[model samples]
Target: EPEVTQTPSHQVTQMGQEVILRCVPISNHLYFYWYRQILGQKVEFLVSFYNNEISEKSEIFDDQFSVERPDGSNFTLKIRSTKLEDSAMYFCASTNTRDRDTFGSGTRLTVV
Candidate 1:
C-alpha cells in the first residue's frame, strides 16, 4: 500500500494567526483531498484537487481556506487566519480510482 504523508503531526497556533498544512499524496494518485474531523464530530470534506486545479470545495472551506498542488507532488492546505472553531484533525487523502482512498495520519491543529 502507498502512503499519504502529512507534516507537523501537531500544530499549535493562536487565534487570528495564519497557518499552512502540508501533504504529499502517493506518487501515482491523481485525486487529492482535504478533510477535517472535530474531536467528536464526523469527518467533514474541505476541498478536492485534481489536475492541478480545485475540483470541489465544501462550504466549510470559506475564504480563509485554500488548497494548492505545487510541483505535481505536494498538496497543501492553508488557513489565512486561525479560529478556535477551526481546530481539528486535518487529514490528507488521495485516490487513483473511486474504489478506495488512502489517508495520512493527520495534522492535529490546536488553537488558543
Candidate 2:
C-alpha cells in the first residue's frame, strides 16, 4: 500500500531557528494536513491545504507555521521560529475524503 513519508524522524534545534520538516503525501489524494501532539497530549490539527490554498487552520497554526506543496508529490511544513513549546511530534496526513485520512509516522521536533 502507498503511504505518506516524512524525513528526519527526529530533530533537535535551538529555540529560534527555522526548520523545515518534509513530507511526501500519498499519491492521488486531494487533501493534506498537518497535526501535532505534544508529549502525552492529544493530537491537534494545525492546518489543512487543498487545491493550492489553505482549507482550514487551527488556532495553533499561528504565524509560526506554514504549509506548502512545493511540487506534485512533496508537502512541507516550515516553522519560522521554533520555541520550546514547539517540541512535539508533527504528523503529515492526507485523505481522499475526510473519513479516510492516513497519517505519517511523524517527525519529532525537540527545541532545546
Candidate 3:
C-alpha cells in the first residue's frame, strides 16, 4: 500500500515566525490537499492543488500562506508569518479520484 508522509512530525515557532511543512504524496495520486485541525475542532480544508496550480482554496488560505510542489514529488506549505491561531495539526492528503483521500500523519505546528 502507498501513503502520504510528512516530516518533522512536530514543530514549534515563535509568533510572527515562518514555517514550512513538507509532505510527499503517494506516487500515483493526482489530487493533493492541505487540511488542518485545531486542537478541539474538526478538520478544515485549507487548499487543493492539481496540475501544478492551485485548484481550490478556503478562506483560511489567505495571503500569508502559500503552497508549492517545488519538485514533482514533494508538496510544501509555507506560512509567511505564524500566529497563535495557526497552531494546529496540519495534514497532507492525496487521492486519484473524489472517492477518498489518504492523509499523512500530520505536522503539528505550535506557535508560541
- lDDT per residue as tens, model 1, 1-42: 679999989999999999999999999999999999999999
Q: Write the per-residue lDDT of candidate 3 for residues 1-112, one digit (tens) a residue.
A: 8889998799999999999999999998999999999999999999999999999999999999999999899999999889999999999999998669999999999999
| Candidate 1, lDDT over the whole model | 0.94
Task: Report the backbone clash tally of model 3.
Answer: 0
State the displacement of the C-alpha of residue 67, model 3, in Å, after optimal TM-score superposition: 0.4
TM-score head-to-head 2 vs 3, winner: 3
| Per-residue lDDT of candidate 2, residues 4-95 (tens digit) | 89987999999999999999988988899999999999999999999989999999999998989988889999998899999999999998
- What are the lDDT figures for the candidates, one per model? 0.94, 0.93, 0.95
lDDT of 3: 0.95
Best by lDDT: 3
Global lDDT for candidate 2?
Answer: 0.93
After superposition, candidate 3 runs with Cα above 4 Å error: none
Top TM-score hit: 3
